[model samples]
Target: MKKWQLQDIRIRDPFFLKENGEYYLYGTTDVNTWEGNGEGFDCYRSKDLKLFQGPYPVFRAPQNFWADRNFWAPEVWKYRGRYYMIASFKAEGRCRGVQVLISDDPRGPFVPVTDGPVTPTDWECLDGTLCFEDDGVYMVFCHEWIQTGDGCICAAKMSGDLTKLTGEPEVLFHASEAEWPVIHREFDSEGFVTDGPFLFRDENSRLHMIWSSYGEKGYAVGISHAQKGVIGKWNHERNTVLEKEGGHGMIFEGPEGRTLLVVHTPNTWLKERVKLYSVEKLILGG
Candidate 1:
């Protein structure tokens, strides 16, 4: 095993989780994330964002696992004394959807909590991110454009235990509703892609979501502010948060307490690498 710096690691949909002063990095870790047999997910730990150690194997598909490919966007959330990995999976005849995996430790052999995807089994969905609100726990995920000509971001209430979805999913917003995302004409003339819907708040505690889609410069990240609350009307920022072939980002408080954003850049297969940025700088520049 070898220790690698930030630039040395090649991953997509980079997710940052800080626990006990150490940073844990998780993402789409398979050698070929687009296709081929999915091997599961690996994690990296670092005291600082500069250097990291271990591609510690946190998950591997079991013999009975229903999904054999497209293991994408694994993000871990700590809730009720345990860590849950919200990730997406796919199979030949089955529709793509997100599932919940559980473990007592951050670095673990996580086991499936939900029998399969908590999202609707028949819908094409991905990037299931956990969001805790005063009312209840929720999972905000993308309904991919691959299935819908116009992609959407939706939210569904989860059981107190995070094991299963409690009710029908409600659409938060569609990719076409956002002003910044350009139609991915390559996929469909009217297609608009939606990926990585992550929830966060500003200093005012106003809820906002950052999601990825095609922009003027290929894959880009955009921020949308919720008008009422977590599941309220969302208004997209006129400009994208990151506009240069980088997307699928997540934000976290750095060790120094600075707000940081992490995204995979170049958005090209095998050429992607994690790029860290100051959220303040991005907002100021955008």
Candidate 2:
């Protein structure tokens, strides 16, 4: 296997997952992510974060697959002994939505568990992340600003088996509700965009979410605290945790149990590379 330095990998919405003793990385791997025929997702693995091996193909659209373009943000989760992938997909005439895929291994050839997206067929949605609670499993996703002027983070209950959505999605919050995010005029003239929504709990067990939108500088990432629980009221931090042309991040406990935040920087096609930040330094001033 050919080993590549982390700097050599160009990806977007970088999702870092640690399983067993190895770190696995997944993301939008296409060379041209904006427009073109959709390519499947891939994964890279490393014992240490500095170097990786393989663009091991994890998923590919099968014959008669519903979506032809814009395959984005594939997040893999281990649930009940199976690996589940929640990712966004869109065809030329269809509204973009998140779909569920499954595999038995972390480095996978993941296959869709559903024929289409679990999100409502009529709604434009993306970045669907799984949130497990005592009550049930929920999928937190973005309702695209292109369809709604103020993009929203919404949650919907998923069946215990994780094959389908059981209820209508409940809006958790909108991009405009946060003080930092500004209208991304170039992308959508009348909308406040929301890119990614990732949920994590603090040391005290209080829920928090980190998501991205255009801020004072450019694309940025910010944290919001949940007043109650997963679907409860959220309070934005008023300032971004990361900015200067980077956004769409996720948190993971890396080697030696260090909590790290990973995001693609420059917000430019092909130039983007995954960068890591310490959560303590970024948020807690540690």
Candidate 3:
């Protein structure tokens, strides 16, 4: 019932989508994102990037929803005249995975379209992000280190209609493969962690991905470059894009047409809140 400024809302994995002249912000809304029976995701809308409105309940779990808790990283993508939200979910006796939900409007009571997660049922996966090319659509997500000693980012072919996955998940890279993640006991002592994997391209049309990991400064955002194409080889930038804690970022063009990177700050439990930075070079030009 309260409105929150960018510095007030306690949310992580912040994703911003600008559509039809309005901005929609979505992500892990729960403070206790690491555990829960999972509360459904929420959305915030605004005409300008500055002032905001409504927590605007976009999704709430139905009684029969497969994920009882740990609903996280919700990103909505508009495709073929409809909107689809790819988010991470978890439950007891089941592995954490990304699932698909649909809605005709960006702000909606989104409901699950797929029977369950498209990622392999046995693997611990999260942060499933959508990417498309002339060939087909793909979901690039993280293969969590909680399940694997070395966390990885994987890509899977999606059905043309975006309702289901069409093939096996292929590995793009791993936490160890990147050089930025700080060796922290809270995040990982023996291994590295891989969080939100969102795809984007710079002005030159060169593919770039901004993802979260523990850096020398604690939780941080790291940048990666595509060597060939969207699903091609990726190179982790030696330096982080944002190393001051708080990652799980998504890049979008603001109303003013400046490229902005939206991410949460602090990166602490119950303290994380959205923050925006000007980084136009991270976005593609028309």
> Top lDDT: which candidate number?
2
- Name the best candidate (by TM-score): 2
lDDT of 3 by residue, 1-286 (tens): 5655666666888888888888898888865677655778888887886667879889999878888888888999999988999998888999988899899999988999877898999999999999887689988999988778778899988998877778888898888888888544554445688988888876677778888888887888888888976666898888788777668898888865787888888777788878888774432221
Which rank order by lDDT, best down to worst? 2, 1, 3
What's the distance in Å from true for residue 239, model 2? 0.6
TM-score of each: 0.97, 0.98, 0.93
Residue range 1-286, candidate 2, lDDT tens digits: 7798998888999997788988899999977677888989999999999989998999999998899888899999999999999999999999998999999999888998979988999999999998888899999999999899999999988999998989888999999999998887765356898989999988998898999999889999988989987877899898899877778899999878899999998799889999999999997782
- Model 3: how far is 177 from its true place, Å? 1.5
lDDT score, residue 281, model 3? Answer: 48
Q: Which ten residues in a row have the lowest lDDT in candidate 1?
A: 181-190
Please provide, for model 1 over 1-286, each residue's C-alpha lDDT reduced to its tens digit, 9 standing for 90 to 100.
6799999999999998888889999999999887789999999999998889989999999888989999999999998889999999999999998989999999988999867888888899999998889999999999889888889999989999888889888999899897888778663345899999888888888788889999888899999989977777888898899887789999999976899889999899899999988988986456
Better of 2 and 3 by TM-score: 2
- Model 2, which residues run further than 4 Å from truth? none
Off by over 4 Å in 3: 1-3, 186-189, 281-286
TM-score of 1: 0.97
